[model samples]
Target: MSTTDDFDAEAWRAELEGYRDRKDEFFANERQSPIPADQRDAFDGLTYFDPDPAYRVEADVTPVESDETVVMETTVDTEQEYERVVELGFDVNGETATLVGYTGVGEDRDSLFVPFRDKTTGQQTYGAGRYMEFEVEGDVTEAETVTLDFNLAYHPFCAYNDAFACPLPPEENWLDVAVEAGERLPEV
Candidate 1:
């Protein structure tokens, strides 16, 4: 993980701007997006908090050893199975927090699925939670470390429409402090 001294806030902001542009395009294009065709006319853009570098943290990541397949509850009544692969311990504000990173089966088994909630839920951000994905390769071991950038946290597709089924963050991933970065309360 990159230390604070090595973290480039300006570059991160540029990357985030690029992400926002792509997301805006995706939302505007009803043919390939979750936004209903009828509502495309009114779609402005996703709401987001100002880019704050303080929310980017370097976490001590440790891999979990278990044959466990957790039954993750989704937006709808249906539930899905996810493998809890790693635990990331970090600091937000003045408090310490830990979030679990999971992985899907088959093709996505190597991908990192980081879903979480903060004190901002339902008020300042998505009612359910936010998600972050790290396109990591190889298995996590004792020496693994990760960057937990809350500035990249995003709402699930379900936030845009009801037709989608998004997996909700487990109770363990909830943080007590307000994470004042990343995507804000999305207007649907």
Candidate 2:
């Protein structure tokens, strides 16, 4: 996998197109979609911020070992516990910031769940937060360094309709900078 710092414009463009196409299919489909059934008719496809190669960052990953579990609140008013699997430190525009990556407590995890909020919240992006998850075998322990493609960050399921419950990003994962990438606010 390539980091965004050495972004290959041509490659990133192709990947972005694939992402948009998949989302378009998901939103347009009546079944197997997170979008509310009642609102499906009016859905013209989900909105997104222009893909920016700059949003992708290479992060240093550190494994977290703690007895405590993070219980995240969901839009449905319920809470679920997830293990804080890794800590990611990266530079965003000359400033150093850190974010936590979570994983479900089970036999094994195949992905890193990164949910975060930025200054763009309530304006350019979702007021609640945005999510980015990458397929990883086991945990970040396998690799001390990993790539965080923020350009693929996306609005939660609840953004489309309230029926689907989505986890809220913890305050610790919030960023002070405006991440003008990925999916934008959904039309209601």
Candidate 3:
């Protein structure tokens, strides 16, 4: 939930680049990688938009009065249930926007899960959506605000291989602006 106002741009960019490098190494070497085993030999790395501080945004967290159980459709013919927990309000390219954060139904997690689709979907990014999660320090209900770093947004495993089924971003989470940050199409 760190703010980017006083962030060291060089350090942030370096850290992000290091993360990307590690991820590439995992994809190319790990057996658990999302890239199909048959395609692992040719796997290079995931494409990414250059890291930009502008994509790191601060969001106002508004807890939901009644936590609603929502069934989200997946890339395949399956559904998963999640509890709608909070609304995250932020700005993107001068446009104010909101996205809902959720958690697995009947599960207590240390982080809030946010899946979303922006104008970059089906073009520059994954068609289904990308995901970002931030660790909650204490009770999420008591949180006033959190940071939504699009620079850390990433495609689900399904994006790399169809064998994996990932939840689609709810319609309410579809963004109108193009978020030109984070991982793009897989090179598998």
Candidate 4:
């Protein structure tokens, strides 16, 4: 009998698999998803700010920005460090990708802001780039070796409708891999 606090990677994996199986239904029913009145008001008041100056990648790629960071909590066993807007660079299908994000802020102090897109846009994933949140180890000042996992990338609410104004991911955040995790767009 493992307690709730006991480590259970298999259970967590099973839960994620369930989400993947029902992603379509989850996204489709999101609009009708109910929330407490107070929570709804808070969600409504949330504003997403675009990155200023519009960071670019290649001549053909468009940049995206956002004010949200992926929230992750610190763990006792990891040597991870917290970082505020850590700078990271990678290559997506031979093209250069860059991302500047912060860590250690509000409630989820170990959170990370990773605004990114990939070559799969308009083909597999949402036409707009995806967002990912992760946990860091230490303070924001020491964020050089942060690990990024694409499996957590998710589409912004704006991707569902034009009525919402969402910031696009910067060109630098694009990933070359086909991230097969998280929510996918609802088929029209």
Candidate 5:
């Protein structure tokens, strides 16, 4: 059998090769067509293989509301930007974070945005919020407010491409725990 040192060297080389292949394919797919929906879901389901696993701790839910609004800004000039709001909510740990979502014309129809960051940023996961798209459930939108689950967080396209300009996670959204779920930046 191959020695442990030899096995490690082979694994490192394989990882590097995989990263390069992924980088090439990422740009190619971006240029070619919209990423397939199934492919997107697959990426969204990725889990971190942490050398030092730091599982997410459940925190108490803290009710929150949105107070800021801005038009969606895009690096591509041709596409139209929509108005969005930066809302606030808490994790199971009571750590505060921002949610990014759409606002409707009528007061009752507005949706909530919940972007967040965690200790996994830049190390085990993307440095940006793992996005979780949510809509208000049931009749009571105030007291029955929803709390975000970091297991559903994700990285923006910018995580893969330098050409993409994704909004950075706000300071409040940054968490102190290692959120160990969702898509991770490919090894490349």
Candidate 6:
């Protein structure tokens, strides 16, 4: 965990709000939106917990040395393969926790994938889980730390429609703490 001494709470909040607005626009208007065609007429914006900087924390990134492969099960009957990349350790609301970060096998090397569930799962948020992904600067192996903005957490497309097969968060990445940030359960 790192101190937010240099964090600009106001700016961060503004940026997050903008992001949410753009996403809502896409979901409500885009033809490729995850919202079902029948529900598009009444489609509203996604629900989100208030943007709180407390949910945005700096995480220490510990790279995994082994070439470990994780077979993540999807919402459907299929599975996806990903390489275990790093362990992100951080503090959220005074609770210490760690989550595993992964990268799709043979996919973008710079993007880090972190699908996880919290106390909010199956209640205030998506029952399956939420996902957080960010681009790592330079090499992931050299990444010492990264920002984990839970305010950016979002539900997978499968949450809105069953046609999309989204990967379920592995048990290893489940957090005991209630991450009351980012998109909440859909109104539908």
TM-score of each: 0.92, 0.90, 0.94, 0.49, 0.48, 0.95
Candidate 2 lDDT tens digits, 1-188 = 24545667888789888979888888878487887777688778778877776777889988887757888899899987888888998987667889998887662567889999998888888888999999885546768888888889989888877888889999999998888888887545
State candidate 6's TM-score: 0.95
User: In candidate 3, what are the lDDT values of residues 54-145, reduced to their tens digit?
Assistant: 89888998988776688899999899999888999998788999999999988775688899999999988988999998788888878888
Candidate numbers, best TM-score first, in rank order: 6, 3, 1, 2, 4, 5
Better of 2 and 4 by lDDT: 2
Give one digit per residue, the lDDT tens place, for model 6 in 1-188: 33767888888878999999999899988899998878988977899998887788899989898877999999997999999888999999899999998999988779999999999999999999999999977888687778899999999999999999999999999999999999997556
Task: Report how far residue 74 has shifted in candidate 4, in Å.
Answer: 31
RMSD of each: 2.1, 2.4, 2.0, 14.0, 11.8, 1.5
For model 3, the superposed segments whose C-alpha errors exceed 4 Å read: 1-5, 186-188
Q: Where is model 2 poorest over a 10-residue stretch in terms of lDDT?
A: 1-10
Which portions of model 4 miss their true places by more than 4 Å?
1-12, 18-84, 89-98, 102-110, 135-138, 176-180, 186-188
What pairs collide in candidate 3?
Answer: none
Q: Where does candidate 1 clash, by residue pair?
A: none
Residue 84 displacement (Å), model 3: 0.9
* Tens digit per residue, CA lDDT, model 4, 35-66: 33334433332112221111211121122234
Which number leads on lDDT? 6
